[model samples]
Target: MALIITDECINCDVCEPECPNSAITQGEEIYEIAPDRCTECVGHYDEPQCVAVCPVDCIPKDPDHVEDEEQLMVKYDKLQAE
Candidate 1:
């Protein structure tokens, strides 16, 4: 599943750079995750880097964007393709 930043986000900017897919971005107030670009770090790491670094644990899985591991891997490859 794609991860989402909740309203609990502090906008501290800590989780933005930790995302391997560059899926996280600064929003008007809280940070937002681009679901289309988010692969949950499937091809880059064992776990989601943004969730690992977030101090408030505001990142949570988006139930609306659920996807399988194979789908995530394919998204990751597409993101890194040149």
Candidate 2:
């Protein structure tokens, strides 16, 4: 599943640089993760980089964009091609 930055985000400006896919961006109120570009770091790391660095622990799987490992890998591959 794509990870989401909840409202609890403190805007620490940490998660943006950690995203290999460059999916995370500053939103109006908090940072946002683009689902199409989010692979949960499948191709680049063992775990989601954003989640690892977020101090608030607000990054969570997008319940609305659930996906299995294989699906995440496909998304990761697609992102790599771009």
Candidate 3:
């Protein structure tokens, strides 16, 4: 599934560069994750880099964009093709 940055985010800027897919960006008040581009690092790493490095632990799977591991892989493959 894609990941989402909750309101708890501290705008620490640690996550944006960590996204292999470039799915994270800075919003007006906090960081945001692009659901279409997010694959939870399925094609890049075993774990999501942002989550691994986040100081506030505010990154979490997007329940609204729910997807299984296979789905995440598919998204990753599509991203690679692009």
lDDT of 1: 0.93
Each model's lDDT comes to 0.93, 0.93, 0.95
Query: In model 3, what are the clashing residue pairs, if there are any?
Result: none
Instruction: Give residue 69's error in model 3 in angstroms.
Output: 0.8
**Cα distance off (Å), candidate 2, residue 57:** 0.3
- Candidate 2: pairs in clash: none
- Candidate 1's displacement at residue 62, Å, is 0.4
**Model 3 CA deviation exceeding 4 Å by range:** none
Show how many residue pairs clash in every candidate, following the order shown. Answer: 0, 0, 0
Report the C-alpha lDDT of model 1 over 36-60, residue by residue, as the tens digit. Answer: 9999999988999999999999999
Candidate 2 stretches greater than 4 Å from native: none
Q: Can you write out model 3's per-residue Cα lDDT over 1-82, one digit (the tens) per residue? A: 7999999999999999999999998999999999999999998899999999999999988899999999999999999999
Clash total of candidate 3 = 0
TM-score of each: 0.96, 0.97, 0.97
Report lDDT (Cα) of residue 69, candidate 2: 92
lDDT of 1 at 37: 94
Candidate 1 wrong stretches, greater than 4 Å: none
lDDT of 2 by residue, 1-82 (tens): 9989999999999999999999999999999999999999998999999999989899999999999999999998887787
